[model samples]
Target: MAMKSSPVVLKTWYVSIACIMLLSALLLFPVRISLASPAVLVVDDDGFASPTDCDGSDPAYSSIQAAIAAAFPGDEIVVCPGVYSEQVTIGRDGLRVRSFDGSAVDGTPDTVIQPGELTPAAVLITANGVVFQGFYIKDATTGTGHAHVHRGVFVQGDNNVILNNKVEGRGTCRFADVGILVRGGGVGNGVAENNLIENNEVTNTCNGIATVSIATNNAAAYTTIKGNTVKNNLGIGIAADRTPSALVGFNEVTENEIGLKYNSDSEKGLPATGTKFRCNDVYGNEIYDAQNIATDNSIMDAEFNWWGSNTGPDPSKISGSVDYVPWLTAPKEEGCPQKGRMTGGGVLRGEVLFINKTKVSATVNFGFEVHCNNEKEPNNLQINWRVGGQTFIFHLTAMNYAACFETAADQGMPPAPFDTHVGSGEGRLKIGPSPWTPATIQWMFVDDGEPGVGKDIFHAVIIADSTSYVISGKISGGNMQAHPDDP
Candidate 1:
């Protein structure tokens, strides 16, 4: 015995069961939604057709601060080429404020930021992981009779990069006229670390590049200052006060009141250990090259630097307890040294070698000779070389062979090398390579006395393909004289 239902009721019952099963399956397996990438916001001085829309299209915001307010994390703010006269504060994380043009040196499309009267800095950064680049940030204070700490770019957060910008005229305030200031304080999880200040020309301020620790308990460490031309400042070129473990190198610190100053306030503890200074050209300052006013007994390592002389820095030039032993004899080039060799098929083939003997004393020897295949034609060639900060120029047109020695007597070597050459006097020809072949000639100098043990310091290089020419060396150190011609 089976109960038989109407066809319509059976169909309706089947439809209801199917609907319930589908709902159950959906509940068991849920669908997932993914997030999209971050967006870009544009800022232009020209009026935006739509102010609310931040799509970075034709209609953009007039002010940079407005764009920053509407931007999300990891968003880029591309500023058009114009003079922005306002105080810009970036309080968001992972935001980039860059010019539309690549760099300020790229002409025409320049992004300049000039602060108003009440503005403390042209650009102030309070967020982490931010990048501020390619802008000419200047004139911190616009009006007179107002004295507030102003800066070109004031950074207070960690892991930030300030690159390839020209910052100048931050000199209104008493103690705050700094081109680029990395204010040291606690941020987020820890103190500010790994901040890179590179490739910027910072000048005409109280201090060119300064890292000050406002918090006595915590100081900024592991800050790297490299490849920046900091010159002609009223105060110290590069000042590191209360900042520890800072790596400073390859910076042209010249023509400033004080080239480099490292001071630890008595109230603040001594600068942390492992502060290294190397490969910097510290010269032509009005006062001392480097001064260390740290009261503590901690010794800072400022080894391997060119103090504008081949004989190294005088004891009176350095203050406090700085270890500048075994200093370099010539200017250090920016970035890593490149090993170069003569290329291209030509008539002349020659190699130049610089040998340094450091075991006995701080003396370097340079040996360079070129051979030409000419029996009937005059064997005429010129050789120019630099060793121990002295340039030696020799004309080999008349002489069959000649040798130049700077002599150990000039460098106070106990056993002086033979000094018998014609052009051994002080007045010698020192000219850089011509503009045509500016890749072959390099001003090579060594740090250590061991031959081929140190890096080569080449200021300029010129490459030529001609057979008959004159060679001139720009002397940077030592007294060199040309040897008698050999037959």
Candidate 2:
């Protein structure tokens, strides 16, 4: 005899069993434990761990990739000073990778990262809010089989920062190599905005510090390159491709095929609208200092920059649609060598005899050298300009020493202080750093092929507070080599 159970009792028993099974599954649940705070991972290629916040594990990571593999978001990795031979990629966001030793003795990091043979890049960032700092990333690998594009540092993520790093190619023979490249492909843009490339030295590559737009993305629109040293690249220094709102300022762009370049060459046909370059020392390029071609008939705003000149940027050194008015009279940042654009210094020796307005005979002789060193001292002058038995004293400073070497053909130049290379100016005289009297100094130097007793020549008109003396003479001896290319 079998007892027939009701549907309600049977359903209650099944529900109880199901509840028990659910409880068992919950007990065996697995979870990924997250660190309470950002952890510091120490990486030393030689496995020596000492200089770090975290105790260098008995055996730290021997390579940078190993440390990154074990890193989580918001973690920091400190690398010891050494040469690392491998390609590195950052996939974790909010992570910072830096050198453990911050003793930047040479303005470059001792922690060097060189791309391995046939690697694509020295370091690549594919995550947002990451920072790569204080590493000398150089292209040292060489091979025949290579990728179409190679770079020292490549950033494809947004809000990433790269500061105080030296990315050099050492004249890499790679088919195409860039020192520091920021780009946005179809999968890369949108979030690929507001990335900063600052205080970096990028040199000796095809291009230095570039923001490129490609594949339905305009990463260049939100790029910023500031306080960077971009120089000696094979191609362009600070190239912006189809950048619409990019800002480039306080950068040194020099000694390349082209200095600062912006153009409208993108798949989206975006013009360089609202792009501006300010406070940059742009000069010494082989071809063009700045080249802009706005396809949309918009003016490329490239004003307020020091283009190696005080009068203006060289017209022939620039081409295309660029607005270069209102340029900086001197280098925006100090310590840059803007030697030729305004004034020049030389070691001069001359003697002249003239008759004063009182019909008195006066003899003047001077033998001195002027050097403008913007490092320790801004300028240096130690000269005795003799007028008869007294020395001609000017109540001014070494900065007022505006001398230039030009040809006899004034070359359609402006007059007085306006003629930079012609070297003529007037200033008040100072007695030992104190304003004493006013004076006007007008002088000229002409290089007659070489320096000799009667070859190169000079002339001067000295107007003192009470007396005026006019003198002319030829270089008796010494050197009058005027460098329009040094500080």
Candidate 3:
């Protein structure tokens, strides 16, 4: 190759070598890149705009349905605080429909949607992965002029979340007026599953929260209904007519004709099996706490629930064969704490005995003796107290559980964190503590983490007089004899 090279040939050769080097470098070291976020559209009812004006700028879209129609998947639609009198149908997936004021608990949600008389629902969701949050859906109309059946919010989709919304149904009509309805039917169309309905206030309707499976084959399963206040309805507070594999927990179902109703006829091949009802305060219903008309051989697991009485739920209240054994004696709300409070004054005595103690953890149990004065027996006496982990407390003669106070790890609370139970008996025993007598309560506690010896504390307060008491004790792998003068 001792020949002389031309200048043009050398220039082309140098460029070719540079291109190969660049390609090798790129293959060896990849560069980091950032993706653009999804678009966010706005809808203001007071604005003068059209469906085409959905760029999330000034003069935003006027109608919610229009913005949803124009938006692509994974877009967000922020609604301004005003009344939108139209039916909104969401058919796009991964869309977030929120109010301008954010969450409903942040303030009074002024983003109200009152559907027109001709509309079937105030808000109808038919798409998957849609989030409808922080809005007031109300005033669904009735009569021959209006739609025969009007719903505040109707969901027929899967993996959707309906949170922090107030749904008040039309008070005029009794039948087919549902506050929030999740229907599952239609062949080839997907059944509603893995959906969440949480932190909502549903009232003044034929049915507060209803999940009906009309299809003969498919069902609405794995739906979670939690942390909702469903009350003052003409019909059932929460109805799971043919919805199986549902988790209904931590709800206040009261002041309705029926607190909770589950009906499934096995002859039709629709059985409401694998339904778990836990930690709910079901009371004040004129008819029953829960009516289970499921004819299937499968039994409904309804345990750890407060049925407004210490003697447990009356067998006459539940219609079908429900396993309500080991029911919660105290109301779920008052006894389950979400925060750790500082020890306070009380006349109660606490004793902790360790069943097993290891370097990693300890298995111990607690005992407390509460002394009451016979002369000062208050007419409506109630006791609220906490021990061990913060989430589960002991409450006597209370209706509901307390709201979650802190994060689970912050308070060292268990997932299902309540253990206290009221005594099962008759007369005053079914209500509250007996006057002038010592009430001794005991519960086992499994302490987690590196534990040598754990100290458990007790805090009790008479709700009527605001009187508080506190006590503490240490637990190790040793038995401590009870005080001779105790009780």
Candidate 4:
């Protein structure tokens, strides 16, 4: 009877255990992972042990195409310094390929892809959000024609940044392509910013940088052609046709047969509209050449426009081997080329870097100062500064470059009241508030339309209760430049 009772109890215990296990499994079903998104792959010409190695791998792939073939959407394939003798095509969205190191030579013009060996381009992209930075693209002997027959970097995506890379030196084209051609591949929103096409020394090319008609209709809106140094090309150095409100600024186009040209409409005789050419130096262009007539071209708000045939001070003197300062003259130099020069102080030619700021308090104020060599007056050269965001444009002006400015949030307004102050400079001063929290600030020199300029030095002074705040900035819309921080 005792043995029978024990058996019955064991059976009951097993049934309870099974019921508990079933309940736990029902509550803890496995989930499926999402792998449909993009993946970042690696390619080292020298070879990598795995995809992770290619992320920053040494002895990289001998060919960039090899690495590109293995990439997916939202994938970043970083290539090491090597010679790739094949053409590469990137047709996926959110794909980015760059050099392992940040040095220009490391990725800029160093990772050479000879397109002659293949029938297509050295690097051809067709998806949105694809970024190609810091790579050298070239045409090989087997390459069709030097004008690339196509392009060094052909992008057809939106939100793409082709920055700090070199696309140069073409051979021939039965028709003509570009060194860097950006177009809308179906519905991509693309942009080309801060790229260096300098010393590319192109020849027999249609255009150094070409923005075509396809980009106009696609989602790739607002292309910015800035800070590019284009030289020695047969066709237009930079061309934007059928593009929507293209913004071309701060580009140096020199020694080209045709510096800058545009025709927004597809109809040959039609004219383009809504294009901007601001603060660019279009000097030493040979527009007199038969094949290079800058016809139906319109220019606005541009600073320096010196033609090669002009008998004036060489614009190259501003930043060249020769130190000759050309006399500023009105009108043209017999060749009908508009004569111009860098307005305002020579010290304005530098770059600006914004340090990130951390907001400590909801309502806070900030203060900052600028340093200068000379201190004189109520208005010698009008100094203009602008701040704020997309909705509001808060502007401030001063007569001297050595004054400080402050912004205090909680001190004014209501829930987020901010007080702003601008004054003379010297020593350690701050912008914003005391016991300050962090906020973003951007400042630059605005031209008040005057001449007889002297060199000016504008240094940024950050004052806060905490030194751990980060700040970021860039100089916009001025003939002057901001210097980069020392490495």
**TM-scores, in order shown?**
0.59, 0.59, 0.60, 0.50
**Candidate that beats the other on TM-score, 1 or 4, i.e. the better one:** 1
lDDT of each: 0.57, 0.65, 0.60, 0.44
lDDT of 4 by residue, 1-487 (tens): 4544588788999999999997766444311134564654555565642444544423334556665665567767777667767778777667778766533433245666665642345677776677777776665454434332567676666556677666664544454657777665453333332222322333445577766654334423345676576777766777765554455544667766667665444344323333444334566666621121223443322222333333444443222121112211222222111111111233222223222343321111112222221132222222222223211111223322121111111221121110121122112222334232332222223222222123222323232233322222222222232111111
For model 3, how does the per-residue alpha-carbon lDDT over 1-487 read when each residue is reduced to its tens digit?
Answer: 6989799999999999999998766444322122343777778875532224423335566788887887778888888878888888888889999887656655596888887652457888888899999998878565567547668877878888899999887764434688887875552264787788888998887789987776664557667787799999888898887776566777899988888887776677666755667678888887878887776656666766778897778766776667776566667655333322111122222342221221112122333222111112121222233334322223333212122211111123322233221111001111133343322221212222122134322222211122122222434432211111212
Best-performing candidate as measured by lDDT: 2
TM-score of 1: 0.59
What are the runs in model 1 whose C-alpha is more than 4 Å off? 1-35, 48-57, 105-109, 117-120, 140-143, 170-173, 265-270, 314-316, 334-487
Error (Å) of candidate 3 at residue 223 is: 0.9
- Top-scoring candidate (TM-score): 3
Of candidates 3 and 2, the better by TM-score: 3
Worst lDDT window (10 residues) for model 4? 412-421
**Position 484, candidate 1: lDDT:** 22
RMSD of each: 17.7, 17.6, 17.1, 16.7
In Å, residue 30's CA in model 4 sits off its true spot by: 28
lDDT of 1 by residue, 51-113 (tens): 234333345667888878877778777777788988888889898888776466445437788
- TM-score of model 4 (CA atoms): 0.50
